[model samples]
Target: MHQERLTKLRNASPAVLPSLLQCDFGDLRSEVERLQAAGIRALHLDVMDGHFVPNLTYGMPIVAGLRKLTDLPLDVHLMISDPAAYVDDFAAAGADMLTFHIEAVPEPAQLIQQIHSHGIVAGVALNPQTPMEALSGCLDQVDAVLVMSVNAGFGGQAFDPEAVQRLQQLRQSHPELLLEVDGGIKPETIGPCHQAGCDLFVVGSAIFGQDDYAAAVRQLRDAL
Candidate 1:
């Protein structure tokens, strides 16, 4: 069921995935409901373990709780080291699609296979500084590729213009695969990312930081 929905989202160019990182946890359920009502197809959950990205974000318990809150797909991004150890846990916790950093995992194919074995979609992420070659020989093994437009540790950072070129390169090579761009995705920057062939745009402050969340989402959706 989730895979079919994901396929539709992948084909629907410029799908906006609001990052829950900027939302107020005190009102998380409402925030998620609001985004869904505003036409968001998926939620991008960033799981950071201070060791990998110098930031400690939410864990699997939060994911388990969120799973019961909304029916939207939980696209969990593991920006932590030793992702292999936690793939089973995140999958059990209700992550519909689990994306781990290529830099963190010694063998990405093994991790992708592990995620698939758990009955969920798998994706690989490349940090802004990480070269495209890192994803070579492995694109066919994963469901998607997350192109980080800014450093992964923190939120509210500026988008790196170089990501545009990377997106173009990946799109050219894997034309049918899902290509997502995260970090610093706003109304102004989304157009450039979309032009670079990014179909999934993971937005943070641009949506949650606004008083009119639905309107903010509409602005991004219309931008594409």
Candidate 2:
């Protein structure tokens, strides 16, 4: 199941995954419909525990709700301290790809295998300041690597220039890895990241903040 989802994601490479964090929850179904109608390949959902990132976001309920809403792949990001504890819950909640922070887990290999056992794509994420070497042990084991261009706690933060360099290094070293960039991805900043070899972009405010979602997505695609 994970292999099939990974193939779908690869086919949609250089795609923008609109973050649900910036969407209007009251009209979530409509927001998702608009994005799908606009041709988004996937959705990015951030699950944050208050302790891990100093901010609390939605969990399984939201993921389960989204599963019923669209067939688009749900790229669930676990910004929590103990992602190992909830892998089963998120998998059952309908996450197609589960990405966890490397800083949060002491032994990522076990967690990666644990996630795969549930038949969902597993990914490792690196914060802005975390060096590439930190992922040396398990880089080849996961399906994707999410490069957080800003701090993980919040949305609408500025894109860190250092992330581009990190993307370049990863692209050069691990040519086949699925490289995703999150945070501050807008029309202007997205171009550079794409050039730097980012395959998937996690965009929040740039898509949802606009009145017309299609035009906003078009602008970002054009910028790419």
Which candidate has the highest TM-score of all?
A: 2
TM-score of each: 0.95, 0.98
> What's the true lDDT of residue 48 in model 1?
97
For candidate 1, lDDT tens digit of each residue in 1-224? 44775675675556899888889899888888888889888888999999999999899998999999987778899999988899889988998888999888746878888888887878889898887898896898888899999998976688899999998998999987789999888988999889988888999889988999889999997887
Per-residue CA lDDT of candidate 2, range 1-224, in tens?
Answer: 87999999999998999999989899989989999989999999999999999999899999999999999999999999999999999999999999999999857989999999988988999999887789998888998999999999975577899999999999999998999999888998999999999999999888988999899999999999
Q: CA lDDT, every prediction? A: 0.87, 0.92
Show the lowest summed lDDT stretch of 10 residues, model 2.
154-163
Residue 171, candidate 1: alpha-carbon lDDT: 90
Name the regions of candidate 1 deviating beyond 4 angstroms: 1-5
Model 1 residue 43 lDDT? 86
For candidate 1, report its TM-score: 0.95
- How does model 1 fare in lDDT? 0.87
In TM-score terms, candidate 2 sits at 0.98
